[model samples]
Target: MTYISRAAKILSSRVSADVVILGPTVIGEGTIVEPMVVIGHPVRAKLMKALGSDLGIDEYMDSISSGSQIGSNCIIRSGTVIYEDVVLGDNVETGHNVLIREGTRIGSGTRVGSGVIIDGETIIGSNVSIQSMVYIPRGTVIEDGVFLGPNVVITNDKYPPSRRLDGVRIRRGAVIGANSTLIAGIEIGENAVVAAGSVVTKDVPPNKVVMGVPARPVYDVDVFIRKRAEYEGSKAP
Candidate 1:
């Protein structure tokens, strides 16, 4: 059954009846919320569950949820769970079964593909394209026009289960290839390209192309662009 909190401000006309909107969530105009999408789910719900609180779902959410904001003209696909305190800018789109945790902010025109998991407190800039099955941990920052290919993994903890957390920063117009694993605390410079299946451990300088296990610099972005143009020219019909 779908549940909408009395405090929610729903301005959209395309919300499905099976969607759950809790707390004081705001659904903007022209947005399409697919079936089984849960918005404004409280982050403290887990704590309450752990503590075995007897409070009902509505009562608990009302007490602890700060709510979330879904901007105008957005598309939130099915089975997506957006935690409280998350903000999505206008024209953002998410694929099916995406999980966005609390305190996350996504800018306008960003596309998060299916099965993507974005942990809390991350900032994603405008027009970023994240392909399918990407895992973005907490504290990550993706600048505008960045392209992350399928199955890209971004880590925040240097050591597993450690207290210290450092995010990977992808500068504007960078392209991270498919199946790449970006380690913690690395900065991918603007317009840089990471070749497919690379395990990036260090910061990549601006406009360079890197490949291999440790992801060494292979060439500059100018060379990569020229090669790309040549390849495209060959493929022209």
Candidate 2:
């Protein structure tokens, strides 16, 4: 059993009874929030509005204040913290201790592993698999069926703390290997495979295999996939 705060907006009759919602967050029917999940933690809208008023840009505050929404049948695991204005589609699942920040939109059937931090304003497509300890910065776009291995770092800023930031875009069916680092503004094309421990600095073409520091295209991704399949088959019992 879970405790749902009276301030929470529960549109669903099937939510876990003990979850804590601190804002005007909406949870769709059939969504399951495990014990200790926190949704819509205070965004200080009023204070933000005041600051914006002082700065002569109060309209910015309005875009920042809408509460979060979880779609039907989504399973939010324990110890996950979702900030305000984040929208999640149906059947999305998150592992323990995941932190999803504000203004992000996650499509259906995405599985986010434990210890993942998805920063604000990210757009993630359906059926994406993001493994543990991956850091996705703000403004990133990940298309459908993308696979991100553990400890992948997707950067969004070319210069540290710069006013301008451009996020990396991963196209459909791209596979980013473990411990890979994608610098800001790089595009991983459809079906591209980034080898483990690679640092990608530029755009990777479709169906290509890239490896090493300042990653360079090594071969066709199909060749790598076939070799991988054969190796796995040989190891099978």
- Who wins the TM-score comparison? 1
Error of 1 at 135 (Å): 0.5
Model 1 scores what on Cα lDDT?
0.94
Per-candidate TM-scores read 0.95, 0.87
lDDT of 1 by residue, 22-83 (tens): 88899999999999999988875455563566787666665567789999999999999999
Which stretches of candidate 1 lie above 4 Å from their native place? 49-54
Best by lDDT: 1
Question: Worst ten-residue run, lDDT, model 2?
Answer: 56-65
**What ranges in model 2 sit over 4 Å off?**
1-7, 11-14, 44-65
Expressed as tens digits, the lDDT of each residue in 1-237 for candidate 2 is 243445457776665556657556789888888878878754655554565364422223323445588998999999998988899999999999999998889999999999999988899999999999999999899999999999999999898889999999999999999999999999999999999999999999999999999899999988999999999889556
- List pairs with backbone clashes in candidate 2: 2-17, 2-18, 3-18
